[model samples]
Target: MDSDKDSRFIPVNDTCNMLEMTLSFPEQLEEAYQIAEKQELIKINHIPSSIATIGMGGSGICGNIVATSAIENIKMPVFSFRDYTVPEYIDDKCLVFAISYSGNTIETLTSLKALLDRSLRNIIIISSGGILEQVSQKFNLPHIKIPAGRPPRASLGYLLIPIIVSLGKLGLFNRYEDTIKEVIKEVEALRTDVNADIPVENNIAKDVAIQIKGKLPIVYGTGEAMGVVAERWAGQFQENAKVLTFNRTFPELCHNQAIGWEDASGITDKCVVISLEGEWEKGAKVEQRGALLDIVKGKGIPVLHINITGDGGLPAIIRAIYLGDFISIYLSALNNVDPCSIGGINSVKERIAPYIDKLNLLS
Candidate 1:
């Protein structure tokens, strides 16, 4: 372990402060649940045949988790759009949700405008307050105002709960009340394991982060929760740790990616495999995970096994996400990088602004 702390890393004091704020996710989730219950009372007049959630970056990732998790359960198709345009197919039969934590995200705002222009049915907006909230009010669209003043990634609970509660309101899901309670408990439990005060030796998240340092992370998950958590981990690695990471769902990976592993002999040494496990109905998932781990290990790649611990689906999922978030932060510290800054992203946006302006003018 590198004992000398790097000065370039987000200051240890800052990381501690952020960790304390991150620990509030459980309480925030509880508050969101309460607000969602009240919001659920609002009538949804038009129950669209399908659902589409529009957002970008962290906000879009939350929608991805929700849409992916609800795939099997939701009777209507649920799709998430991370781009600037709403799908042309979205119309009166679609429930379009424009979710932007900052409410200023360019892509989400663009998609929201497209949806509004088409007069999409059952349009709802979730934002902290910006142009999105203003437009929602002007159009008389159903809007949920979440508490502001946190990073978009940190506000996952706020961004996600409203969508789930709205689904429950629309009669799409019935067990949300029970699920919310379970998820809260799970997040509270996870704090003991991932909290900043916990020494590195005692912290599972820290241990995993240390193991993956200097190596590309490849996260694999089996069931719905696992898949969603894997994707979250990948995003955390990208935004928090500024590390390259990839994710893929199981059973699907078995079809093609599994075969490509043989040709990856050299690069395999530079990669770490993380397997995410959860309570899945399909008993064969465990077998598949075991086989994949064995295959990768045989190829000389290091492997990390993380078991999702919690009672219900929502809690288990939240626990996994919490673990990933903590691990990514620790990895940021290990890499000697500021976890809160995204210079590359800012530069990319700056360089693209001129083209965007020209495109807007052309449109």
Candidate 2:
């Protein structure tokens, strides 16, 4: 079906129109920033000793991005978790952002309740509406409400921008509002090249999708900034492309994963490496990335290196994500799957609903 060049096949393959959502990402970022800017700045009397963001799956990923982007910028430690339990070390002095797009994710609710139980007042809730909004109202907790109905994965801008802008307003991060403005412009330009209307002859995203379409995709992030992006790319491939994908950070993977590649030529043939190389990465990590790609190529595996392009930490991360997102959607077209159909996840959710009801942790 020449998924990259044939426009007719796109509609047939992507019945749910995930391409439209991907196209709107640039706009989403702008709108998200405006929404966040309009909110009254979060007021915390004291500088938090640390910051933690908690959630699972799509919603949880924003926390990872926040922590990673803040690594070199913020003085306080930042942590992100996808588990039901909050880390014991996160005392009342820690600021917590509890994210749940649906506001009913059992794990998030449980963890938020845990924080409340421990008398943690430095809590901010972000959700579209649901149990989370209700809980916020019940407890008089600060809540940032986002527009509802979009899939949590598709709401990355709305999910992430509020946290960044709020923290920036409180002097925790610098140049964030400006950085976001640049990101919007970069992504808007990027979207033109990656969007569905662009053909394989000109679209890097489509070309990359064709290269890795049938192979297992393993995303490697060159550093902390790209590492979170690597995770997001893998997730997009899973949900949008309906494929099993994995992600690992550079030097760390060089130590252990490289060893597996040495003796696994047979399996290597079925895989493609998509390395998210950050321009901001240290030369040492860049060298490691090149070496790692060479090792994979020696074993006859295909390698696709995506250079992340943007002005700074957050901007670069967003640009990479925007490109990867389009690539994932194109890959979905090749796979002939509806990108929005998450039947497996929905089935699991159905099975677990009763158990969550029984627990009644929110009450």
Candidate 3:
């Protein structure tokens, strides 16, 4: 029962059906935007000298997304913090966005408290009601409550849109609405193009799924927005497809990771390189990648170069992301696994639950 021949690879299976969640991205995105747009954002008079986002796992990605776009949108420094310790750059002049889908991520929660201990006056909590939200309510911090049902990873749109909208409030970017609509259109188009209804031979996502079946995915992207998408792709593959991935960004990889690809350990046979390239790629970046691409190809490696084009801006990033999502689901089917269930993650959570705390002091 080869999936390519039968075309069952795209069909939803038991244990998890992520298709509906994928389709609901537009709605989730709109909801997130409305939440941010309506909120009476605090500290409107004083813009932070720097911005630090605190979270781990799926929720943490929101910060990374903000950081990626913030660097390009604002002159101020912005970055995400994943550890229990808050970065030293965060002070009263810093804005901290604490994100946690479940609202109870120990690391993010700890990081939030650490920031508060520093007397950081500006902090916002985005969550679906966990310890994070509870503490936010108690501490009188600005909080955005998002709809919850799907896993944190599947809540990308719901989580990410607010950040974009908030940036709009800060005058960092003025194109949230248009960019969101464009992203919705592009994702819908991507859905139609890569859905199970489309035959494998004609589907780009399916083709990549087939090629990378049972092999490790090595995702490469440039330093800009595309790099963030590549990280999301790797995480989706890990959580949805139940596969491991290696990641590298261009320019940086050329210095060390490029030469490491030299077939000393048969990596060429077991891995597929998925390069995420943006249309706005500059000549210097393109030239640097050319040499790296040559080295990988010279070793007889398979490469999937995805060229993201159009004026969609943020939407272009989502389009590429949606493609990778479809590929993850298809890969799950090919692997005969449930795209919806993350048993390994659950097991670890249960293992750590014994030491989980009440955080009564926060309340």
Q: Cα RMSD to native, each candidate?
A: 3.6, 2.2, 2.5
On residues 1-363, what C-alpha lDDT tens digit does candidate 2 reach at each position? Answer: 345356632635665567888889888888888888787745688899988999888899999888877864567888997888997899888888999999988888888888888888788888999888888887778888999988888899999988888888878877887778877988888987766777788889888888888889999988778888899899999999898999999889999988888897468768998888766666787888788889899988888878776544777888888888888888887888888889898998888777666645456
Candidate 1 lDDT tens digits, 1-363:
233432222335354355555778888888877776676333566667888899987789777777665654467788889998876888878777888987777788777777766776477788899778787777777778899877788788998888888887678855776767777877788887667667666779878988999999999987766888899899889877889999998878877877778678679779999988765535677777777778788888988877776432666777889889888878887886767776787788687655444323113
At residue 174, give the lDDT of candidate 3.
Answer: 57
| Model 3 agreement with the true structure over 215-246: per-residue lDDT tens digits | 88999988668788889899989988889997
Each candidate's TM vs. the true structure? 0.87, 0.94, 0.92
- Model 3: lDDT to the true structure: 0.78
Better of 1 and 2 by lDDT: 2
Query: By TM-score, how accurate is candidate 3?
Result: 0.92
Query: For model 3, how many clashes?
Result: 0
Residue-level lDDT for 323 in candidate 1: 87
RMSD of 3: 2.5
How big is the positional error of residue 34 in model 1, measured in Å on the Cα after superposition?
A: 3.7
Candidates' C-alpha lDDT? 0.77, 0.83, 0.78
> Candidate 2: lDDT over CA atoms?
0.83
User: Which portions of model 1 miss their true places by more than 4 Å?
Assistant: 1-16, 37-43, 71-73, 310-312, 352-363
Q: Runs in model 3 with CA error above 4 Å?
A: 1-6, 354-363
